[model samples]
Target: MTLMLCSVAAAASAHAGELPRLRTEDGRHALLVDGKPYLMLGAQVHNSSNYPSVLPQVWPVMQALSANTIEIPVAWEQFEPTEGRFDYSWVDTLLAQARKNDMRVVLLWFGSWKNGDSTYTPEWVKSDTKRFPRLQKRDGRPTTTLSPLGEATLAADRKAFVALMRHLREVDREHTVIMVQVENEIGSHGVARDYSPAAERLFAQQVPEDIRRASGKQSGTWAEVFGKEADQAFAAWTYARFVQEVAVAGKAEKNLPLYTNAAVFDATGTAMAAQVASGGPNWNVLPIWKTAAPALDLIGPDLYLPLEKTYLGLLDRYARPDNALFVPETSNAIWAVRFFWAALGRGAIGWAPFGMDATSYSNYPLGARKLDPATIEAFAAPYRLFRPIARDWAAIASKHPTWGTAKNSAGEDSTSMGSWKISVTYGRNNFDIPWPGMEPPPWAKEPVGGGVVAQLGPNEFLVAGQYSRFQFMPVDPAVNGQIMSAEEGTFIDGRWQASRRWNGDQISYGFNFNEQPALLRVKLSTY
Candidate 1:
């Protein structure tokens, strides 16, 4: 705080080894400085209101995590509240501070959308709906939507957004802000995807071939690609329409990496996501987003679902040759490895938990409205594990096209985690106990313990569960070829540090009943 923060013409990290020079190459995403694979261990502090002031205070926490990139939001309300008014001073403050801190920024436009709510609308247009417009529901009611039919909303959104892109272009072409999310959660709550008569008219019509050409399909209507899978009849048109309109505006500005976020829908049926929308995007309608927003590089997931099954489904949805998977928002704390592993195994470019900035987050559990404390504690473990491996993973993914496709280099399933493993089938196997616990349930068969596992480097990993004493064995020569150990610590004052060690053939940390998870920085030493 006392010293003048140095700035990178393109990007800079305050301290040596504080952050890495990051870039994505080919069709893969990785963080590299001169040219070595790096994984991006990042956190998104969705703090828009407290920009310049909070940035200096907030960045030290990120730098302590050894975080490579910082994902911050530049709200539309602040940037452009009026038709021609554009204020980028906050962005200037943000970038300059980030450069000083030696951190990179991934800007989120809290414009036309943010959790599907237009809460960021500026004072001028927000007060006047007649000139701006709102989307109508089936009952001819105004559904808290920025009218998809409103040209003023579109113009306001585009102008501010274009200004943002232009600013980032001139200031960030060095790619300091390596990528940008066009809008926060596009359809997390826009129910029925705008039933406005104008929206309806566009929805009923066949999708233009230009969209099809953009998406990569040679032929077929919206329903044809996704099928009336979920009223495929109207959704394809609506979702495509929404994506196309936004994408055109963004690409029309700058081609810097662009993406949109979607909330996950129920996998059981094609029914609209009950908590949010009827016509909003689910897994089935991605092709339309791809086609309609060709210039838009990816349609990311804003995951809140706790179930691992749904995460696998979501990963399959966004993981594509052309589309790299990145989660803009996900559950704060939970056994999120199922999702993280899925993203890495399937070649996701980037991922982060939303609202990570506030310490109050620890007390809130999930989002402002949702509380799932166990889920939060479960996920907080991985945040530390990623610090050392962040750049390495990204570099590997970028260098290795097969990076995302290879679920396991050594054959581990992507979905397994420690806490769930103990509850799942641990008491059933005959394998001897490494940690404490006599197994569970009278119906329990043998002695087997299952926990969560993540491979950071060749042999290095972080593994934990309902507390375990793992007796590891080598099945292959590679497994036996290296000396292994891990650093055990939690995020204390923003840095990942080791409190103790679990030495010898097998090491263990954490108690069996606390519900708290232990993370290890597994070091696989070749020398």
Candidate 2:
């Protein structure tokens, strides 16, 4: 009996060590699954769609989008309704159904904070405000946001998170759960930092040495260290430390790749921290979050800004040498789908549109007003094109040079890959200039156009996009560049299967990508 137990224990340890993780090389990152690079064609369900009864509404949507990963919530209230008592029935059901559907899971832990509020906490935690204190406003009145400074609250949340991780280790030996989100949009909205007596005491004291060094400031109080941004900086430090404790404890249990999503602040440099979610992992406070939460694999942005510059700018901020870009949530509007190319171009590890389930709840102004067929197709088109080649793309992107673009505010975009300059124009016909008396395409004025181009070799490229014309030219005008061959195909089990070849009219003007799922492997040559 002793020998058998030892063997079982060794196997479990091996499995735990092989859990999903993030790998970064040459400033690009990949989510390593089953010891190989994996791309997340992900769809995040609505907040309340984790119940067994509601799960039936989710799988069909996952099938519709051709998503390989399901990002769903596991509410702390539902997981531990009674204090110190745990219930993982819903988690088990979710894992079982995901396996049946052949989908991986990214469990969003809606604990302590959900969208800048503590509403997801159990009745026990919510009712007893004294034990688990709430954040105080400037006037000393308590707000709905919990105080990260509260030791009791931290201890409770840490204990619950650890329990969840422990249970995952026991039941998830097959590694169905690829990643875990620590919390949802954690931060303080309306007010910058907790103004409670305890919070104020810490605020007046010298800033922690680690944070001071990370921020490149001399030893001083929060106000002295951060100056005008003191309040927001303090809040970020407090929240980051709180999340760090929880993540550390949880990792000790299962060692899965854990991350936290930020309710992104304004990218225009106009809105202040208090105006947005102050303590969240905003672009400005990313250094603080990184310094405080070293255990977290990454801090992902919950992108909702759909504009050209602002959206792309946030991608630049998060997809850094130190951080991997993962859009854990974005608007599911048709117009927002093009940003997927932008993210892919930046070598994002994962991207998911929020509220993707058929739960009949619409976030409206934040996302699509409805989950109609057209809305579904808008997202489904891009997923269909990449689903078969996701793993291939993930591996190539991690090791190769790639570029992605979306229709700009001016209805065109361009980038340079190696010696070739690639430009794209949306809403055009097969010809670069329309023939006399020809009408413009129906989608000419529509808000759509984007594609991703990856350099496979010195003069070879893999290209894919929709509703745009991709033209490649040699950077040096002295050399004449031409498309030697363009093969339309998809990657099957890591091999490219060419369905047809494009020539004559197709290559005459440029590679015109209509509203179809098409991928191209193009080889270029100089005349």
Candidate 3:
């Protein structure tokens, strides 16, 4: 069996008129760039690194990480500091530099809200509080977040977003900007919904017909329709409608697969709406967002949760048939890198870690404290290994059944492929059985191990991973299984070149993959 590579170079040379789009089939999705499947091995720079001056500190990290795409923010304040008088200088600079480095861009529009705050709005808008109203708390005191109920705010944000898209159309004809994030971590913080007089009037009004139908409530006020989740549900609808208008207008200018990022909260449904980013597209409210914002291609989660259960659970929640999984922001910490496999197994179109730049700032508890070599390598290793066959993997994942896992606190995980049970053990050495009095391995205590396996055929598999050991066993108790052949190879320019074959000592024990990048094509047979 052979795996065909989708060459990035070939994709770049496609017809310039072709725009990037998301294609979904059989509950799987692919980000098609230049009319072909594209895998975004992406890095998101620091929030303030969008200007021309700070870009000098960004490129080196992209090169080091081997990232093909950069998710950088284009602040509303900076993009249109003077409102109607727009400036596209920084965008032009970014596009020119990105092309020079052969990188695609995922522009984050930090408009109406960012992390549920209005800090990114222009001075003109911020100074005029009456025109762009802020969300009011229960005490009737205005909060920092912009009110989703404000028509003026939505109109202004939609205008700015449209202008940015129009500018992109004029400049990026080659489709260098693969996608645009409508806003960043949108929602309210202190309260579930705005308590202003205008918001109160609307809250008492009957829920819109579309929302009523989506929620299976024929007709009633927001409070009556949603019951306990009334406030959050209302808030979600308000934000979704606001963003939908902006996305619709922007798409009209140049449709390039628009999406928004959510500040993920409790996945277990224990956290109250008021405790999390209430109005955002959190997992619980995805249905509301989907029904309200049909124009948005997808809503991705900004994963800060590092636990195996939570991280993997969130992936399952977001990777649905109606919504394509695209992790726009995740922790850049060493332990978090393994979830890259989890995302891939879920058929995620793209995954990016937050705060990936040479800038001296770091979002500590959320990511690595510093950009150390170890931290950098943790993320770089997977990208380096998959860079050559990214397109191939994307295509295969979109079509085939795949499974991936990371070393959990228990240090192991397993899944089934066809008739075989594939078990992966982390921190294992070449030896399957420990000698007398053998101590545990050093990596056993370390937080680094995971891998992904894809079924190429009924009895053939493609596997790549690090710091783990893979063993396959027959599911049927009566049958025995053995590896027919295992080839160690790497894909180059869409072709697999075998460097060697594994047998005897190598096949004596299950495949032991260490820190070094290893790709294996193993054919199995039942005896």
Candidate 4:
């Protein structure tokens, strides 16, 4: 612990005036904290579970889960209950609790929108429908979503967000709060888009030049330019512009990385887009949001998709050089751990499961409820392993190419990274003294193995995985590859403490890892 503290101190000392910022290198992105790249092992609380009394439940569970950051809501209703007055007791309390627990925070601002509903808005704003109107449907029915076209609505949200940022700057100069989520799953719901007069007027005009440039269209009305998808595109433009204004205001107060999360379009596409939140950064509308909201740092998707390919595809879509991949909210299911490796392989800065406290919501998904003991154990595995090598992992992730694979029924999988073709097999003891057979453990029958391989050099690799074995072969036929050294170790106090030199039978077949995550440094040579 003392050495860890010294390492942290050294990092802070190295960069005297640099504020917390995001850096991109070698086509990958990382969040630099206190002059060192940090990976966020995060868990979020329920929407209504961030008050002082409820927070006690939050810390214990997060600590048990080994989360380094807590994502919780700071609602507009709670922050400013009345019109012109603000209360920051909630924010102060959260900072104090996070400091005590040695955790960082990604404060989710539930201002104008939370899950496509304005239920978290202040009472004053909600009551004045004329001044701050709700989004009107095509048939003259008003939805619960706030109209992004309203000047009063945007102004009020911008004011409140700026106030919160100003307060954070005054009280949190050390940056206990690392990032701020501008809103929660923001978009229009229950309708494709607003049918109000203002929205209709904007839709009727020539598609804004910037939006046209972003979406690769030119000089046409929404209907003419986008055809059937124009409604959702128009809505995305207005909503992103509104959020962008709020973001610009808050950044003016204190510049910190700000992002928004999308309620991704499911497989049903048209129906889902019509009924669910279709605007804000959904894959199809991502270009519109990016062009309209220049103030936003990144846009990430909430992982609610049921299929693995769909989930992985979304990771590929958003994991672009221009944007950083962050799963700010996800399920707590045991199988979800594989996506953590997937995200890391794509150079994501963070991964977090939503609703992690000792509380439950009626309408929530099964894996998104309060944590049970088993769930905590499931989450703790990856977090405990990553927390130690967080700095190293972030540094390596930005500049090096990496690959990850989930176990197959055959208990083996292979992928290419750099000049090596890496083969991974899942099983138990590899040593002949313990078990002389090639057969795997009973658990190997299940999808219980997965790992990430990062190429540190042409023949040198950093391998971390659970319940798996690794064997690397050179891609160049003329060169024969053989492992020169394989040292299994733990990163303690910023130094690798080798536990056992893996040789003899261990290296004869392959390097084996148990259920616990094992970090190894392997060097290869050509003959």
Which window of ten consecutive residues has the lowest lDDT sum in model 4?
A: 361-370
Query: What number of backbone clashes does candidate 3 have, counting pairs of residues 3 or more apart or in separate chains?
Result: 0
**Winning candidate number (lDDT):** 2
TM-score of structure candidate 3? 0.96
lDDT of 2 by residue, 414-499 (tens): 88888899998887887766467998888888878789998888799989998888999998899999888999998765667899
Model 3: lDDT to the true structure: 0.87
List where candidate 2 sits over 4 angstroms from the true fold: 1-17
Candidate 1 RMSD computed on C-alpha atoms after optimal superposition onto the true structure? 8.5
lDDT of 1 by residue, 206-311 (tens): 6577655655554654556435442343544454455566667766666556677777756555565534644445565666566555666667777776655566
> Which 10 residues in a row give candidate 3 its minimum summed lDDT?
1-10
**Per-residue lDDT for 228-329 in model 3, tens only?**
888888899999999999999999999999999888856777356555788899887887899999999999988887777778888988989999999999
Error of 4 at 45 (Å): 1.0
Which 10 consecutive positions of candidate 2 have the poorest summed lDDT?
1-10
The runs of at least 3 residues in candidate 4 whose Cα sits more than 4 Å from the true structure, single-residue gaps closed, are 1-9, 265-271, 360-370, 407-412, 426-442, 445-448, 477-479
2 or 4, which is superior by lDDT? Answer: 2
TM-scores of all predicted structures: 0.69, 0.95, 0.96, 0.93
Q: Count the backbone clashes (under 3 Å) in each candidate.
A: 34, 0, 0, 0
